[model samples]
Target chain A: MSSTDMLQVISKNGKAKRGAEPNLPKKTLLAMYEAMMQTRLLDERMINLQRQGRIGFYVPSTGEEAAQVGSCMALDDTDWLFPSYRVPGLFLMRGVDIQHLVANCFGNEADLCKGRQMPVHYAFAEHKLVSISSPIGTHIIHATGLAMAQKLKKDKGISAVYFGDGGTSSNDFHSGLNFAGVAKAPVLFICTNNQWAISVPIEKQTASETIAIKGEAYGMPGVRVDGNDVLAVYDACKKAADRARKGDGPTLIELMTYRRGPHSSSDDPTRYRGNQADEWLDRDPILRFRKYLEVADMWSEKQETELIERLKAGINAEVKKGEAAGQPSLETMFTDVYANVPPHLREQYENLVRDEGTGHEPDPDAAFPL
Target chain B: MSSITMVQAVNDALREEMRGDDDVVVLGEDVGINGGVFRCTADLIDEFGEERVIDTPLSESGIIGAAVGMALYGLKPVPEIQFSDFIWPAFDQITSEMAKMRYRSGGQFTCPMVVRTPYGGGIRGGHYHSQSPEAYFTHTPGLVVVIPSDPYDAKGLLKAAIRCEDPVIFLEPKRIYRAPKMDVPDDDDYVVEIGKAAVRREGTDFTITAYGAMVAVALEACEKAAEQGWSGEVVDLRTLLPLDEDAIIQSVTKTGRLVTLQEATKFCGFSSEISAIVAEKAIDVLEAPVKRVSGFDVPFPYTLEHVYMPHADRVLKAIEGVMTY
Candidate 1:
């Protein structure tokens, strides 16, 4: 494939183009569409929840569901996933307990993070999904390492990490991709080039022809896909996953997608991006995939309605369950620092309790002398 | 027990751990074939083979970030930073990613890895090679900072760090890696518990607290003080974080005067933290103000490397100043 050529398995009209069909099972394709819809509704609910002050923060996967869900569907349950702030679709596709994901947004006592991290920093150990840290491109190297460890153990598992176009500018991106290439680690680095990192456009992020082409510099195969086309994204990921399992080394897949909503609930896209985003609205992966499924005679209007109602009810119930979990206790702040709390920390905790009784702020200068 | 240097002790500890557990792997620049620049990982590649002993590209961030990933995947990766000064590139991986993995995952995932690096100044490595960056690691919660002064402690603590369930920053004192050989146990099961300070010498005149290379320097300073008819107690803090406050408080209570020594710069250094803790718990028992003998508050210089580090004279001066006060 040429460097600038985009690999697409589906066209804008929701029809399989020549040499593009992923040939996934009809059941699997239907499930992928359901996950995309579920993710869309979850993003909408989360954005609404944040606006209503029910949740603290949110980063909606809005227009990029196909890129997130389709690629995730291509991987097996054993393959590890290291997702970025976006891509809740990937988590949903992996069967991550929605309750846990929602509870994390609430940062409640039941939350896996123990209220230590921001919302969307979801981590489910059983799912083989590593915890999400706020730093962009950091997980790329971590995924590479996980792949290396798997390779050392002679395991057939591969690691898939997802990041945004903004992550490409991070030094860790270079470090991770270079190391992965040199080590021939079984890792798939998927960059959802959503065209913006906060307000910074892709044009200003790098002057390179394409993010996928940069993989060549790091000694890895690079491929660009029509990220909005779920089939295309799924095909690219499946191929990369196969290559990784066969010890063909890492591959960088730049999913050509777009962010339909503001960067996060905290951001205002109108300030940076004009009405240009309206053009991407028609390219909605959910709508496009729904049309494709209808042409395949595997979907109906009733099915779409049922899925929407089911997801709305499920997400709403989960939000209520999440909100009801309540805030973590004050003592939780001191816990999880270490497996065993050391003597000094225990004493410090007692001191805090003692100081709390007096209802006064700690005066370290008064407590200790020069 | 076998006589060995800190470097040899470290190599033995890594070999022992790698042999004891199949999950234990060592990775870093020049760690495989070259056996590391300081020879701390010498012969490890041949013994453990290339799979377990990985020679990574010269990228500090990559080394640490990948180690965190490896640790998450249930491997005990002991990654080396070559020198403590080079750890800056991996600071984000250590502080933001590795350290927070366990806490952020609510104990579901843990980075049971050891980051080994040579630290401190004495053999004229200048600024780039010589540095005591323990305070930075100590400042980060969810991280265990260990610095061993001698071969015995180096071997024992290293073995313990490798088995630790959380991330550990093992700062090997480069200056004393070869000097002052000591008896280290050859047993594979030998391990010194972290977060416990060792009292090297017992005295009542004053207490001297130090770690890593400063432990030997403090002992030498105590010897010089003894010639002046003063007896001083010495404490070697094997671990910086989860600091053995009980040991520190106990020593200060007995001596009624404290002198904390460190090779890091004076500003916000480990010595200051120790001094603060001493003042917090044992102020009533103190006869004189706690003194801190530490490096100057400036970047380590090439020409004045010795002067920039806390030597016996500086430590003795603090001891004498505390006594006179």
Candidate 2:
């Protein structure tokens, strides 16, 4: 009786019920199901590759695909995505090429960032994916900056920032949220409450009953959604996105999802809490949406099999293409740090080139002005 | 032109910039009615009204974050950190957020703002108030750091910073705020661009490169050496970013001996930056290694305030050391 009936459409019974909200149009529901499947397969491949030592490091959005893809589907491509480290699923949904993802994952020559950053740190400059950095909450402050610019440019656009519940405790987060609140910047802040920051839990992170309620102090509406239910998250984000585009200011949407996988390839969720993360598997976002698709006569086992086979082939092709580009050599380390490579760096670069000659340079002939 | 202290010149520039640009705003602790602890914001709240001249809470992060917000909102926000030493609380906001906002956003945004803070030792303000921490901000990207040496440059450069399209860290030489008085223009639009250096005195013997209070100290040392027939040229590096390497290289090339002076601790200070430039670009031009007369790495002490700061005597000694070598 206590909060059993929240924002959900296809309940856990695997049957269509009378009282639940009506399903969406066939195309829309099927697309959501497709995105969830792709996210799961992509994340699974990356995790396995990491375990095989084929990739450097990775942070997966495994159990939280519904939170990421569902929220992204609500956003327009013109809107911005200022994500932190752990949201590769968002980039995939935002139309990042699977091969480009593999290139970045391998830190290869064809990577857009030129192999400067670690794997899983993807940035789609043309698609409005603000470059992701390794820092925890720094991107939140930048989201405020971008929202401010959007308002100044009178673009009538919104910026949705993604971070975990843990980042809400950082100074940059506090300053960013406080600034956004005061300026009434057009932004949709989606906190993917995966419930664990590495090993720390939501209880230790804040004493507040819920992270969304903290948005009240900033003078904005806060909405909570059942992060496992794709429809709930999608509906909440759509509403928030609309409010932002209409210049109604910001909205804080707390998606109560779970990180079913380990925090990263390097982490072990079992080291801290075992059954909680594994239990979320039964409520797997991808499976739940699949069930919804089947019940609504939008999907079938035959179509599911074909779609997965296509995704696997696509991923394999990207891996081969990325490996063909090869890793950056040593000289790659020295560029893109500053507008002009200052004389000190130049001298050091020359010294390094002289010290090792062309044999050790990362990209010897690749020279360009800043 | 009327004679006023360096601090007043800064205050006059802020007042004029606000009057000129309707978007200009001033915010900080004690910066409103109290005219700031050093009176830099004196009469500002009265002239500009409360909205433009805001007195904010003691939170440095809040002040800087608010300023960045205002800048993004199409307003020119100039926040005061009160003292360079107290700026650490806002370091995250400045370094991570404000500095990289423009570049990270791929030029989609810009922060035309300023963080004004008093720096250096002379008032015995101990470790808390007397530290010259401009080195911290200078190391950050997208931040234009400028430290004026006298009244004239302070007025010109501050107007420049107020009009700049990037975030500027204006470090006022607290030690020389009232030390030397000079003629600063009243109201006409004048600006010294960032990345340019000024030759305070031209000579062919020893080239002394310095900024902020050390520029005054270098000038004093130049005069003292001139009495002993040791000709000296003094360079006041007004802007640290886009550093005037051309002027510095020219002077060091001409004199064949140079002395770099700063109040910051010797390690990783601007002095080291200048030295690296000289070493990399014009290694053969030096008669002796570029001698750095900087404050020791020890924390700025209240008791030995005079000894701790880079003084006129240290300036002269460093120059003499370079000249003799």
Candidate 3:
């Protein structure tokens, strides 16, 4: 497919375009829908928790569920996922326990990051999901490196990296794609072109006609897909993964979607943007997928209600458990910095432990007066 | 044991490590085929093949950034930055990502990689080629900053760094990469433990604290001081992050006079940290205040590099100043 042409499986009215749908198993299709629903519920609850001062901060991927979950479904379980902050759906699709995700949000003892990282920066090594960092496009080169290693070891699995349109302009984007193209690394560069990066529009982010087309400059094929349609995302990603596995080098797949909410709980879209575009609102990924599911007799109003209630209750219970678990151990601060603590750090830890609870504690309510 | 240059020692270390572990890979610009600009990776491509000794693009950030990923994937990647002066481009990856990977991931993910770069002035490489940026890495926690003075320590320290569970910044003193040959063990098992300081010269009148190329200069200054009826102790601090505070304190307490030397700029250099450690720990035993002889607080000069580097003369002056004080 041409870079300018966007692949679409499901039409605006929820009807599948003739012969365009992927041949996914019935169980996999239902699992995709469930994961999308779970992601939406979790995002809404987390944002509400942030608003209620129960959590410090959260980044919601409300509108791009299809892009995140569908692309994730296309990968092998052994394939490494280097994701940005806005791909919580990808985490859920990969079977990350909701309670552990909530623990990360609460920065609790059970959190995989042991409260060291900021909220929503999740990492699960067992699932081959690399830890998320705040810096943009850095993981892109890492994915290329891992993919190169895979190629050297003749591993069947490839690596996939997820970033946004704004990330396309970052230096690492150029470095990663160029290196991957040269090495013919078995990797997929998935750019979720959500139009806005914080406050900067895509128009200002780059002068290129399309982010995907920029892949040609690095000797890679570029494809664009209707990110609102899960089938299209899955199809494009699956094709890209196949090519990468065949040693055809990396492919840049741009998932054309929109950020339907504020960048994060701390951001206010109303200040920088006039309003949510009606065109994008109509093309909401979850609603479009739900419509497609309903049209296929795979879902119904009764099932939707039950699913929403079940997800809400499950998420709320996880949030309650995370909150009750409290913060990580104070000793954890000195641990994990090194495999074995140095003498100086050991002394510092001893001093802190000796003076524990002696310092004045700040009021939690007054800490974040937002 | 074989007497060899620092660069040869580094090559031996890499060859030995690669031969021992299939996961130990070396990647950098011109590291393969061309055998690296300094020949530090000479004949490695032929031995380990292009896959292990990779010649990467000229992007320093990509070299380090990709190495971080390789390390995350259970490969001990030793990525060369070519020169420490060019390391700023990959500073974000080195500091924010590589160093903090294990800690930020709560030990779920770790970057057990070594970033090897040639550092320090006296190569006449001017501004872009010569620099002593060990202070920057030393300031960063979670990074084991090691700088070896001679060939013996280069191979041993690099092996220790490669075996380290954490990320290590192995800064090679390019000024002495070819000079100061030492009998380094041919065995792969030889490793100089990290965070321990080696006392090169024992004395009682004063103490000279230094590392990397400065260690040689400190030793020379110690010899000159000995000729002038002053016994000066020289401590080679192989690792800077988990600093050899015990060695520094012991030497300072014994001599009661301290002089710190480094090729880095005088302001906020690793020498300042050494002086601070001595002040904090061995102040009561100190007869004179700690004196630091370091590069001037200016951009590393090209034509004036000799004036920029701390030689034995300047170190001797500092030693005499601290002795008289």
lDDT of 1 by residue, A1-370 (tens): 9657998866677788876687788889888988999888888998888887677788888999999988998899989999898888888888887888888888777998887787888988889888899878889999999999999999978999999999999978998899899989999999999999999999999999999999999999999998999988988899999999999999999999898898888888989988879999888888899888888899999999999999999998988888767567666777778877777677778888887753443233321211
- On residues B1-325, what C-alpha lDDT tens digit does candidate 3 reach at each position? 8889999999999999999999999999999989989999999999999899999999999999999989988899999988888999999999999989989999999998999999988989998898888888888889999999999999999999999999999999999999878888998699999989999999999988888888989998988998999999999989898988999888888889999888888899888888787777778998888888999999889999988899999998988898888
Residue-wise lDDT of candidate 2 within A1-370, one digit each (tens)?
1122235555774554456543457776677777777878888887777776667777778878888888888889888888776676677777777787788887787877667666776767677777666667766766765676576567867888899999888876776777678767788888888888999999999998888888888878888877888877887788888888888888888888787887777777888996777677788878887887787677789999999998888888887787667666655555443433455456678888888775653343221111
Alpha-carbon lDDT of model 3: 0.90
Best by TM-score: 3
Q: Determine which window of 10 residues in candidate 1 chain A has minimal summed lDDT.
A: A361-370
Q: Could you estimate the TM-score for every candidate?
A: 0.97, 0.84, 0.98
DockQ, all candidates in order:
0.79, 0.27, 0.87
Model 2 agreement with the true structure over B7-94: per-residue lDDT tens digits: 8998999998989887888888999999999999999999888767877656688778767766765788889989989898888888
Which candidate do you rate higher for DockQ, 2 or 3? 3
lDDT of 1 by residue, B146-228 (tens): 99989999999999998887789999999899988998888778899998999999998999999998888899999999999
Ranking of candidates on DockQ, top first: 3, 1, 2
